[model samples]
Target: MKVFLTSLFLACFLLIIAPPLMAVVDLYEFDTESQRQRYHALIEVLRCPKCQNQNLAGSDSPVAEDLRRELHQMLLEGKTDREIKTFMVDRYGEFVLYKPRFQKSTVVLWGLPLVLLVLGLGIVAYIVRGRQSTNTRKMSLDELSSSEQDQLKSLLKTSSEETETPP
Candidate 1:
């Protein structure tokens, strides 16, 4: 019983401490402060293909680590940000970028929201104008011309008389 308890306590302790020990932190030395800033910025804006939703800087997946290493190496090589982005796009396709460039292929992705919004506003405006016209055309008894008032009285009298008669 004592041995079982000891083993259980030891397993609990190891479970508690193992996760922190397993997390890997990258420490790359840059030649200049600008290179370091650029490296950090690029990682922040780039998505991890394996993780889908997490950016490179936030993901701990092996693919994210490899991409971070590749980005650091590219910075050391003095590649422009555009060139690095181009290389990544070429190798991984455009899904690796957090903000894809505007191109013919992406026109619908960018323009659809604006088109939908304008269409929605147009429909709303049409509905509102139609309602406004209907409201304005409705004549109150006080607003009706004398001849019109006489006609309305006759119609109401006939309607009431018809309702009072059988069938």
Candidate 2:
């Protein structure tokens, strides 16, 4: 019974700790601190083609691993950041870039948010103006003409008389 309890405790501890230990960690050596920093930054901003929205730094897919290796190789070859990005774009297309450049091809991607925001603001303003006009019309006692006021008074009197009588 003592041995079984000890084994159970050990198994529970391993289960709790194993996930962190099993996490994918890339260990690439860089010639300089700048290179290491640049590599880390590039990986963070580059998306994994296989994982859709996941960045290379966070993705554990085989494609991400392969991309990491390719990036490391490029860095070792002393490729400029722009050159590295261009190469990746050429090979994997713009989808691999987390933030694509503003070009004719990507104008919609960059401009869509601003256009939608302006459209939304215009719609809200129109709705607010409509509501304000309606509220003003409803709330203003002086807006009622003499004839309308007289008709309103007669209606109120009739309603009051009807309400005062038992059904």
Write the residue-wise lDDT of candidate 2 on 49-139 in tens digits. 9996999998999999999999999999999999999999999999999899999999999999999999999999999999998987774
The TM-score measured for candidate 1 stands at 0.79
lDDT of candidate model 2 versus the reference: 0.94
Q: TM-score for every candidate vs. truth?
A: 0.79, 0.78
C-alpha RMSD of each candidate structure in angstroms: 4.1, 3.0
The number of the candidate with the highest lDDT is 1
Tell me how far the alpha carbon of residue 79 in candidate 2 is from the true structure, in angstroms, after superposition.
2.1
Worst 10 residues of 2 by lDDT: 135-144
Model 2, position 135: C-alpha lDDT score: 80
lDDT of 1 by residue, 28-126 (tens): 999999999999999999999999689999999999999999999999999999999999999899999988899999999899999999999999999
Candidate 2, pairs of clashing residues: none
